[model samples]
Target: MTQAATSDTNVLDLSTCDSEPIRTPGSIQPHGFALSLAEDLTVLQASENLAQHIGSAAAGAVGLPLARVIGDTAAALVVTELAATRVLERPLYLGTVCISETCYFDVLAHRYDGVLMLEFESVERRASADFRNLYPLVGEFLLKLNNTVSTDAMSALAADEIRAVTGYGRVMVYHFDHDGHGHVIAESLADGYHSYLGQRFPASDIPRQARELYTLNRIRLIHDANYTPARLVPAINPVTGAPNDLSFAALRSVSPIHLQYMRNMKTLASMSVSLIVKGKLWGLISCHNETPSPVAFERRTACEQLGQILALSIESREDASELQFRLDLRRIMVSMLGGLTQGADFIDNMTSVFPALLTFARASGVAIVVDDRLLTYGDTPSDEQIRELVGWLSIRAHGDVFHTDQLAAGYPGGADITRNASGILALPISRIHKHYLIWFRPEVIHTIDWAGNPHAKEGAGPLDQLTPRTSFSSWRETITGTSIPWHKGELELALEFRTALLGIALERAEQMAELAEELGRANKELEAFSYSVSHDLRAPLRHIVGFSDLLLESASNEDLEKRHRFLKNIKESARLAGKLVDDLLSFSQMGRAALRPSTISMNDLVHGCIEKLAGDTHGRDLRWEVEDLPEVRADASFIQLAVYNLLSNAVKFTSQKESAIIRIRAERHPHENVFHIEDNGAGFNMDYVHKLFGVFQRLHRMEDFQGTGIGLANVRRIVERHGGKAWASSVAGQGATFSFSIPKELPV
Candidate 1:
């Protein structure tokens, strides 16, 4: 009953076996018969051996109504049972029905793609396990399953339980790794059975299409691998106009290549129940037998249920394990960060916390890059190699965290460091500072025992070129240059640590920036102080020397009036020099003095400043305008000096005016209070405003304005020390206004 060779497979290459259409094989196992029917119960196609199961009357069943082939009673029962089952793709069992006087078959029906598929299995083939036997087996398995502690324990329990129920020679719980290769994790074998408990299988062993089919059809069985496959009567269904999609069919004939695979393993019958966890095919509960063994549908159903429970147990345990790992990482991070905060040097802090840092992500070695310096712990690459790897990572990275199990594959420069750093997990703490935290894992060399040499193949045939490997002996392979992969919890915890470390790095960077700015300002102030000392202080001293010399010469000539005038001139020059020194001392003290803020009336402060400068305005006809000023909290003495400087400048500059007009006012704001003093004076050009507040900076000539240029600079320093600023605006020769602001809530 084998399918005749077709032109489609004439050039089939052994390499392209994965593309073989296994689901549309247009055949069924000899143990059962299948029917493809239309919506109206018309038989579109039937198995060629239908007569063996039913009678000669139903042999040519194609193009006939289901009632004409299997009789009205059986067809009516199928329609009635299917009517009660609302879902599609899952077959519903319709209790055993007698087709002939001695022929009793268990019927199953399901619908897919507008076609209803009916399958019949003869009850005489296998003695059906009654509920009395099925219940105790399932209940015991569930009870023990709940008691199992780990995935391996659960898998072992499942293999034993499934073998107990199905009477298979051996059962193995196969588990797939992240790379798709499978290995047996647990096994239950009968006496004298050869074990494959530790053997691995390549991903190609079960081709991609076959794995996809396993997901859709959770349970599949080959009653007898050596039995002939019963081809469909018409080969193609009239409704689909092609081979029927038997993905969800119970008795669908599998690929010939797979049948050959089973024979190579010396297994005449096999069954597989997919372990579908979280909607993905995680693994399989594979069973094999040396002799022909057909499992009843009821026993197969129990195995499927057992597989589901096993998948759930594995998922739950994996979740619990991940949670525990994350909690452990968190504990390690807390201790490590605590150590970090104890030291100011980043490298020193990391060095002290190195042990917990390694334990944080289960890394074998660690590298901390700070301020362009590389520090290593335990097994790691050389400093030069690490720097090169970091450089490459900086260019290839798309995010703050990057990880790979095969660093040599990911980074070309890492090839030389495979023994020490085959894998790396890099987290950039601060890209601006070139700060990075990298963890390394050394190469893990191990040998793998594959079920067979996956590379070996037999010579190709013309029609069916693909051949399953004949040998099932153990084939050893040595793996190198790769480390155990980083788990999801490990990567996730690394990201969390990166976020926290970035915060600390950014804060440190900001503090450094502020320190640099302060240093620059201090340097500028030192330069200005030097200039004032060399020029401003020297001028007054020279004047006193010249005046004293003149007085001494006039005394010898008996010119008492000239001598007295010279003495007065020398005395005045000395007083001016002393005043300049006093101003400089006050300016210097402003920065060192701590703020002593108290509530004060701005009105009284302004009036006091005006009164102090009354000496300069005594001879002039002056007019004053005062406004009600807001109250502020500030250092009273400093505010007074600042006000006095502004008022004195306003009066001295307006000395030539016939009527000097001065105005004082204050502006209130939510955050601070601003005050202004306006005067009709000989105002300087606006272009030179930037020099108004600088030490020894002046706009007018020395003879025209009789004072040192330290007055405005002192004003700026005093106000600034009180968390305020002083500035002025003026139009040339028209008037000038000086303003300062004091924050209501001054900085401590």
Candidate 2:
């Protein structure tokens, strides 16, 4: 055959091997012959070796009913069996049929690409084996498989069991890892047979098309690698005008390169059974022989059954293991939530669960970042590196989590921290705050034992065809700059953790929002206070000017009593104006003051404020009702000022009463302390209550209640500074109650 004999018409090289069209090689192994027939049993194409296998008439059978070549009885069996099968791309046995007086063959039929492929293998070659005798072998394998526990153990058991059934020189269980690289996990070898037990094979060893074929055809056998391929009479199918899809044909010839690969390995025959788990080709059970060996179809069927059973076992074990791993992650997530709800800041709570966090995703390190604050645990990169990573994460991770096992491939800066952080799983705790919780995995440096140096390739073959590697010795490859790839389960757990972290972060963010609002309110009040101060101060200055001008006018006509009265009035007004100026300065200072909280007895604090006001209340008929007050955590000086303002206002407002009554008490709730001051005074109307807490906002006439309105504003500011609140409730003529609340736990 010339190079033009292959449909691809390209020399097999590293660049074109993947597209080699191994499925449509247009030939069959010389041990068995294949025929491409139309739907009505017309022979569209026949193998060239039909004359060697059957007779000269069979060799020229194309464009004729298959009954004309193989006798009517044999062709009828193929037609009847295919008529009963519904699913396509799977071979159905037609049993043994005699094409002539001496030509007896076992036939298999399958449909693909609108054509029926019928493959024939000589039954005389089998000494005695058939399907009826293979059941006990299957039953015995099942009984021992129940004793196996781990995946490795089961793989070893399968390799041993398959070798015993097939009598292969070497049988290996090759498992594919997450990276699509295969490694020999278990092996059974005969005497003088080489072992590939611990070696790895790159994914390129089997090109993409070959793996696809394995998925469609679960078992493939090459009886003799050195046999010349018997070419089909018509290279392309007449119906499709393309190469017939021989994907399901048992006798389909494999790629010449693969045949060369086997020759280089010093093997004459090979068979492979695919291990498909959950509808995906997971690995293979590879068998090789040192001589031209052929197993009966019955034994091959038994091996196929074993492969199915092995696939199921592997799926069950992997599912069970993943389930347990997810359950473990759930427990760690529960512990993390417990810590987060302890009323500390997000960083502190996350740090408290650092050990569990590391174990949560099998991470080597973890980092919690909120705003500009960063906290790290276990093995970690430098602070600068983490911050840089956070900056990058902030752009992509809006509300979802992001993860990558090959961090350096996606993030250039990651190359510098391969030792500490080759993999990263980052969850955005709060996008608003630029907050994140990240887990890190360090680079795992290990060596791979390849069957040969994968990169080593020799010059082209005699006809410019790429040759297979000559050596099959173990070659060690030391890999670097990559961590163990994160599995689907781990990525799922990270998303779950993200959901939980968002909840805690949202709660903390709400508190921050409240603080922001308070600051905004303070700013507005400051602006209003500035406007009201100038207006109120101008009135006092106007009164001083009016009295001094009147005194000056009366100076020329000075009666002694008028002169004395003017002087007294002038001096009293000057003192009142000075007092208002001092109060305004104090109010300004209170707004800017920082809170220094300590434990204080509300009872003692209230008593101190009342005693300070005793001089003004000494001559009045005043009654003081003091209820027991609770101890609170607050700044002593600030609380005292607030309490003084409330008590002093109570005293002045009720001075009109013949019998003045004042009450002070406190109440404690689960989260805050509420204090109230009630007075039986000439209370103001509730219509204008909103103005009660504004700076210099007076609800009553100045002549009726002679006091600055700055007191309540000052009280509100002091209370808010400690993350508390203050308010008042009143009736038109009865009395008023002033109240304030302070949180049990302060904000940081």
Candidate 3:
């Protein structure tokens, strides 16, 4: 009674072909269907069929009664089996099950009246004598090794081991997409073949039918395209009892174009070891044979065993990817933190520190939240634009990189911004961190040429573009990897990163508020300090001057010589201290003073300086040649101070000369016309010249030059405040020249 029974398909019947059509405890048969039974063989003689196939004598125990033969508990399962073959007239799939006490074959049953015949199919008992049969050992090795190091290098290392273990023409680690578009990403080919390193293919060639079955089933073996099918009873689906074998190669009537394509790709027999990540398909480890060849039973078994571990290894790689992303993030944040302290540009600093970030994030351009007028370098956004975008980002509360799609969701009101842009990444810049590192990625548009007419070839094995995707359509969906929804865990992890960033933004806001408060307090303290110093020092200055006069007038004649000398020294010291305090007060006041611009004649100013000096001290022989001078807009008092300081310095330093030769001239450089007070003086080291204009930075000793060092500093302060710079050029024991410029007003 071993017959392929196809009585009525396309019709579902709940009516029992056997007794009662009993439900299998948890099963509801309304959704369940029945199968027709195999007929015309002696019920007992059928015992040989089960015995010869299952290698168990108890299979012969048929027709002894349903309970004695298979037991009543298995009744519904057997009913499922009968419905399968009877309705479909082809093979069926049954869940894992047991038959006689000693033997098991996943049972697929069909019955007629009191008569019942059941078929058992092997789940996977293709074990062979080889090292690969011990999967447990390899699994442990992979698990232990994964913790200490990366598997990519280890996988390459395993090439020799894998080749020695499984003899195939070429063993490649083929990566696959969620849609089953696969490519041979890594391979160990013998030689003499085109490399498939960066090649891609269509998912439809594998077909939805094939990809779905790959996870539920593993260890596919095609001895040859021409290999004859082994004789066996067929089965139907357990749920629907439809023709069951869903294997890709099992399509006996598959297109001839597909067969040729497999051959064209130089595959005689192939065994693909699947690398599944999560429940979604990730990639594969496919082994190919160029010639018509068969994988030995052991090698096939080993490949399958190897696949199980590789699948799990691929799954755990998610955590590895996350960890690396975090490490890179930490490194970037640390670099940004360092820039804040060192006064470096945040974006540029991060670029040098995280060089691979561009490639990792697929960024075409990176920008920071910056003001163009304030930041003179890099592709800084204009102040007007920056202020607007910053306000928008703050209002919308942007935190992470967003695909163009995300803007529609993040800011529904920001639809116009989204339309103008392809993608935007918003990184926060906090006032507490002055470097304010924020990263922006502008979408780089790629003008991809569609295979314009995709599917120029069909009937190609695993090479046809099937399903909704076509070469003619835009491939934006595939590039994003966003078409298939993210797993719950992965989406949650992405959300966690956003949560961390939100925390940072809130902390930044608080820091900014605190900074504002601190700035106000500092201003008050500075005003109080300035006022106290001014008031407290003036009384002592007046008393010192008054006492010095009294001492000079009242000293006794006998002690007049010594008393006069001491009194003179005290008077000089007191006057100098008083002058020092006045200079300090002036420096403080200059910080808050507004500019008073005037058209000052440079020649008039130099002449005025010479006349003042001439009146102050008896004339020394000097060569004072004033060149034609340009009228410059400047503060009149500050310009006088500049000329006075320069004249005073030249006069004092050149005092030692029997005939001092001082030259006053003006010359032009890139931006401004500089006037100089040049003199052959006792100059200092050229290297320390930069420190010359700073307060208390006089080159001459106090006894050598009877003047305070504040004069040159005051000159520099005034020059800078006039929107120009003051500098001196000199060599030790040689002459010196003091030059200053008043910058021209710039256009707004």
Candidate 4:
């Protein structure tokens, strides 16, 4: 083969190279003949070697119907298949067609660029016999594959099987990584042959265009790397006036640069089958022969099937492993939730679960942020570095989870932090506050063994051909500032953990809200109680002093009835002052008391309160209507006190009525039970309802009610403390109803 020369001005520039034009090269390998036809099956162009296989010369076949050039049977078969579909990546084999009395050719038809392209190769009568014997071997190979456990084992078994089936000098399983670079993971070689296992190749060696073709065709064969490419007679299709697309052609001529690459490696023949896993190209099964060894279509089809089976097996094993990993992580999360429930602080709970997070994510370190506080565990960057990382992420991360293995490449300041933590998986627990839970992977300093020095050549190759590297020796290079990449399972686990962390944040917010509400109520109650105590004590003291002075002035000379009246007035005032003090102390005690809840009948509690209020109802005409109430979980003593206060107020306020009616009933709710006390009493105005529950907040004068105004206040305090609410509805001159609801269950 003559090498094409390149002028100095037109030397190949790697930076400006485009691989798209390679798809339609308008040429075929000389090993077979190709013919392109119009829509009416008229032969437009034929390969130069068409005369060798058929009775017609390439120039003479032009403008002739394809049926006359090949045969009526072959052309009819091609038309039948093409009529059903025009786009076919896989060719339709039309069997043997007799072009002449002594010559029979195997035909393949495919549609490309609106043109029907047919390829012909000479076939012997005994060709089917060789393929028939290969089926039993294929079945046995598949059975052996079923027993392989891991991906590596499967790769090794597949390589050995392909080598045995093809009789190739070497067979290698080349696996591509996330970055598109490939490494020889498994290999089967002849004795004394060089091994390519554990050797890496750069992504540019295959290029994006070649990878795309591999995905589409699935298998490619090069019978003779040194053979001259056979040109089409017209070079371009007559209908479209464009180069024919040979992307799916079995005998499509390869790029000259690739041929030079194979020649430099001393490879005479080569074949490759793409390994597609879950619709993506995973890798390739590459076979190289030292002599010109052409693989029959039947054998290559078998290789493609084997690759498909291997891909399915790899996907199954990977899915199973990931499932088990997720199950284990979920178990760990359950334990972490338990720990969080027992801990007093959110940050402390996260710190306690840090080890579990690291294990779940397979990370080296972890950082948790609750509000403005931050906590880190294991091998992590300095506090300052972590703060910077958090700040950087706060601005860029848009979702609940963000992860990257090459953090330094994305954020320049991360390079400083990469010494201890290169990869970061961040989960924002609170987006508003920028609170996050971050997992980190330590920088991994490792060496890569390349098949050849990737940096050996510069942009000095010929324009028509890319220079191939001369060496195949292993070249070692050190790499840094990158961690082991995060897998899909790790990202999923991070998102799951973020969900749990968010739950914790929500729970904390709820607790804070309840606490703030309780504190506000307590402050208001304290102020009311203070004012009530001061006024009640001072009024009684003034009464006692005034009556005692009157008694002292009357002495022995004054009338006995007047002295008796003064003494009696002083005694009554002192008693009233003492009772006021007792009531104040009781209300204060209710506020300070702890809750000890248990299952109790609301009916029994209400009945007990009625019995205690019987003394107050003795002089009054009372009618009681109490309904059956359900059982509840609450502090029994506190509930008793609350019921007593309500009953006492109902009885005292109704004393002025000729016939007072008290109705006590309970209504069931989804999460709580509500009890109501309806009383025909001296109902206060609705406008003063807000003040009805405050200590010393009285609508009626003391002379009319004849009691200190602490009963309703105590009732509100006790009910609220029990995780329930108290409210009242009333209108002046009408009956009033007081209702309170308690939860069905109490928290421990």
What are the Cα lDDT values of the candidates? 0.83, 0.84, 0.52, 0.81
RMSD after CA superposition, every candidate: 6.0, 10.4, 21.9, 4.4
Model 3 ranges with Cα > 4 A deviation? 1-167, 177-181, 190-195, 207-209, 224-268, 278-280, 290-297, 309-325, 338-366, 370-400, 404-424, 428-455, 458-748
Q: Output the number of the TM-score-best candidate.
A: 4
User: How do the residues 601-706 of candidate 1 rate in per-residue lDDT, one tens digit apiece?
Assistant: 9889888878877887887899889999999898899888888888888888889899999999989899988999999999989899998898778899888988
Model 4 root mean square deviation, Cα atoms: 4.4
> Higher-lDDT candidate among 1 and 3?
1
Kindly list the per-residue Cα lDDT of model 2 for residues 340-458, writing each as its tens digit.
88965777777789999898889999998888898999999999999999888887555577888779888879899999899888887764767788899999998999988887755
- TM-scores across all candidates? 0.76, 0.68, 0.39, 0.85
Order the candidates by TM-score, highest first: 4, 1, 2, 3
Best of the candidates, lDDT? 2
The residue pairs in collision within model 2 are none
Ranking by lDDT: 2, 1, 4, 3
* Pairs of residues at least 3 apart in sequence or in different chains that clash in candidate 1: none
User: Alpha-carbon error at 730 in model 4, in Å?
Assistant: 1.8
Give per-residue CA lDDT, model 4, range 1-748, as digits (tens): 1244454343223442344366776678777789988878788999988877675789888899988887786677666766776545567675556666676566677777777778876555523314575677667877887887888889999899888878899999988998888989999999866898998988878878888888888888898899888788888777778878888888888876677678777788999999988788899999998888877776777787788878888889888998998888888878887788776578877777778878888888988766668788988888778888888889988887888888998986987888768899988777578687888898999999998887775345343234556677788999998998887876786687678777876888898898888788878877876786678778888999999988888886659988889889999999988888888888889878889888998887888888877787887789999999999998899899889888888888888889999999999999999999999888889898999988878889987887778888888889888889999998777779999999876654
Worst window of 10 by summed lDDT in candidate 4: 8-17
